[model samples]
Target chain A: MTVGRKLWAIIIIKIFIIFAILRLFFFPDFLNSKSDTDEGKGDYVREQLINRN
Target chain B: MIDQIDLSMVDWARAQFALTAIYHWLFVPLTLGLSFLVAIMETIYVKTGNPEWKKITKFWMILFGINFAIGVATGIILEFQFGTNWSNYSWFVGDIFGAPLAIEGIMAFFLESTFIAIMFFGWNKVSKGFHLTASWLTAIGASLSALWILVANAWMQSPTGMEFNPDTARNEMVDFWEILFSPMAFNKFLHTISNGYVIGSIFVIGISSWFLLKKRHILMAKRSILVAAIFGLITSIFLVGTGDGSAYTVAQSQPMKLAAMEGLYEGEAGAGLVAFGILNPDKKPGDGEDAFLVKVQIPSLLSILGYRNTEAYVPGVEDIVNGGYKPWFEKIPVEEKEMTYSVAQKIEKGKLAISALRDYKTATRAGDSILAKISQKKLQENFNYFGYGYLNNPESVIPNIPLTFYSFHIMVFLGFYFILLFIVMLFFVNRTTLEKKRWLLWISLWTIPLAYIASQAGWVVAEVGRQPWVIQDLLPTVAAVSMIDTNSIRITFWIFAGLFTALLIAEVMIMVRQIKIGPKEGGSK
Candidate 1:
């Protein structure tokens, strides 16, 4: 375990974590469909209340 | 009309926050304190040319590694919760809240993770100086993480560096520095870090003492206790000071929170602080049935802490609840004419009811006693309604008071106990042999769980006391939720529960493996 090797190991870990985080943020659709359904439901509830009023 | 639905949402969100926050805290204190311990051990090795110091560092690092893994796992869920349970709040305040979180991930997480890996696996690879530098950087990274998280949370409590936007219905940050240096942020960051230092120091001292008592690693144990004691003393004192500052800030900015924390009911000059109390709001404080166990009264303590004067007015629960003090809304002025008309109608209705009852009594005097009794019952019910404001029984608005009360007490009691424990350890280390005191060693071992309990109680108090409010007075918790169906929440909750549980178990397994291995055998030389 040389200094250069250690540095490389750390760098690789960081790259992986960062990449995962970015992918999760960008392609959030693949991870979960609940977010979209959540948004739709919120809008539906608000619209229903408005219509009743 | 929407209150019931809103209340349920608030409760659910609060429960989720409580679970995550408690679990997150279980690891965070150790991270903060353990980082410092590792840095100190490495420093001692570098200075004293002792392989034993290296061994001490390695052992604690193993525990630190376990804590870090769980901390990271729990922390991820917390961030997701902001979106899942509190989606509206995220949308409303993300502009302000998201900044610190982003900085924490970018600046602190990278530094921490990078250095941590090097420190863990780079023993034979890096230069001595480079290795030591990695350890120190990791320590700094942990502190920086605390700083950023506290900044975000403190901003929520006190609201700094932000202005209200009518269009977005949210607060937007105006200045980064303002948010960073806000009084709330400063106090909370210091207080939290200090607690971390205390926890970390106590843990090292406890484990080292255990080894010493067993006659294994006596020399290393002695050094570890000495280092821990020094840190323990400094952090103990710092914790007290920072706690005072935090309380003072809460009194100024979040008076309702301060009142709830103290359980004050009536306004008074130099009010007595409740050390222990069976808080029954249905009865007065000294009613003998539901009274506080008054242990000690430091006169003018609250006033001095809050206002820098002994006579400053601290508003009580009654004032806040019944004084018509709306937090974020303007008071509407009543029209005198409309008010008079309403009052006259109420009075007229009452007079007509009284006359009808009197007539029924007179008419039934010589005939039916049963009819008269029925009329009297109706009259009494109507009168009681006017007097009590409603005939219908309102649903209970009370919080789970007993749980809140004891959780609060447990936290406070631990705070004081830890203060004394640290003090005693410091004294023994400075004067007598800390190793000889078997009783103190055992106590230190037990303080490990005490730290976790205190951390949990703090979370319980914050989330539980806030109750219906997700954003403290501005937004109700239920209104802040994502409009997803109950089934959706249930599904995600289970998924998260499974994932977190697996991560927790994995973390524990790794920690046990490291501890079994003990310190690394080879020396750098």
Candidate 2:
């Protein structure tokens, strides 16, 4: 392969590893499990801001 | 895209958006500016048939390509983030905000993307005239993109051409043209793009001055410096007018933002402009303690600048919160607008609206038509300030004052300083004095970062001053996040930060190496 092709191959692989692969394993939606309804979610937000520990 | 209504959710989302915007900005302004510079150089090359000019154009073109590539990469994330992080905001204002973004994609993106290839690789593949057209089109495309995005942003600051729909729980467009050509949008576009022009000029001058310092590309450096300085000087002066127009728009549409930007806590008819001041952090307005630790001000200047009247009352944060600015709100178009809400009155009205929405929901649940109709009337009447109802405390309405105030002042001070620097440089440019005056060259070289900083500060004053509410009176940021893990957001923020930083380092290294290589050596084989 040419140097240009070699560079492109590594660049694509690096970006995929960092952005796509790591994201799936590490970042899961935690806020969804916190509450069910919108009102309950709103209350949680207010309490966090207004009555913070 | 679900509502993640929590503080950490909001914080992490905000952090991610801010990080992306900050990184995106570091690249976008240069692309905006350099594209035109390269186009101009290419035009010169085509006109004069100078191989030297072609080489010069190509050198800058290479830098532009590197910058544009990263800018495009960062920009996609910003657009996507509305769905990923600010899902609620997307749904709420989607009817209004979605249109401009769609236009930008269709109009600006296609034009830029199509022509940019020709600009970069079309040297001998396309005819000479066609190549020049591509270069110009690419520059115009970059600018056009800025216009559409600013239109959307400015609409958020001063929401015109849209009305609240109680049924949909959203703001819908009433007049497309009103939103597109809003006074706020026009001012923002002009001010922002001109700032980009100034940034471009400074970038060229700064890099050119560096070449002069080392005496490497002295002829090209001198030519670049002369060209950029003239362009810089013109735009720098015009920025004052555009900046004034921005302040006026803010005063008329977003009085609280202007008040917070000034750190004024009390209403004054003839408020003086703060020249320089130290704000006393502990100072409270009603307590009668002066907010200024040390202040020097031009009397009545703020009132005149903000309201164009020495006697026109400028309402401060305290006045706004305490309902003293009711007249100001009443003055905003017709009292016919459901949105003409003063500070306390807005929250009260918003709570009523919220109550009505609940009632409507309850009535619907019971299948009671009559009750639903009654609740709908009340909901529609007070729907404008519904976002304010989410607030538990009135004080939450006040943005972080010191941050807003300092950012505004820093932007202003640095702006005037740039103008003065350009003026002095313009004076000495033709004479041998420019090269002899090492101090000016050194200052100009360093001022590049400050120019970028001023642009960022201007945005800070704008975005920070409108705090709590992401859509002015329409939506608070707390209610605008996607349902996601705080760690998820945190992880993404770090990932983006890491990637952008790595890319930036690589970019700087490449740019530096290319710059050192000079146009002659770096020219295409």
CA-based DockQ, model 2: 0.12
Across residues B293-376, which tens digit of lDDT does each residue of candidate 2 receive? 998898988888787777667888777777634333325543443433456677788778777877776787699999999998
lDDT of 1 by residue, B1-525 (tens): 233354444555566666657656777889999998899889888888788788888778767866775556457667776755666667656467888888988999999999998998888899878989999999999999889888887876766676543223345789889989988889989988988998898888877777767767777777788888788878878888887888778776666566666666555566656666665656443233433444455677777766556766565555444433322211333232121112233333444434444544454645767766665565544431121121011111123444555676677788888878877876886655777888888888878778878867765665565444455433445446654445544545555555556556655666545544455556221
Best by TM-score: 2
The per-residue C-alpha lDDT of model 1 at residue B244 equals 82
Query: How much lDDT does each candidate structure score?
Result: 0.64, 0.78
Maximum-DockQ candidate: 2
- Give the Cα error of residue B378 in candidate 2, in Å: 0.9
lDDT of 1: 0.64
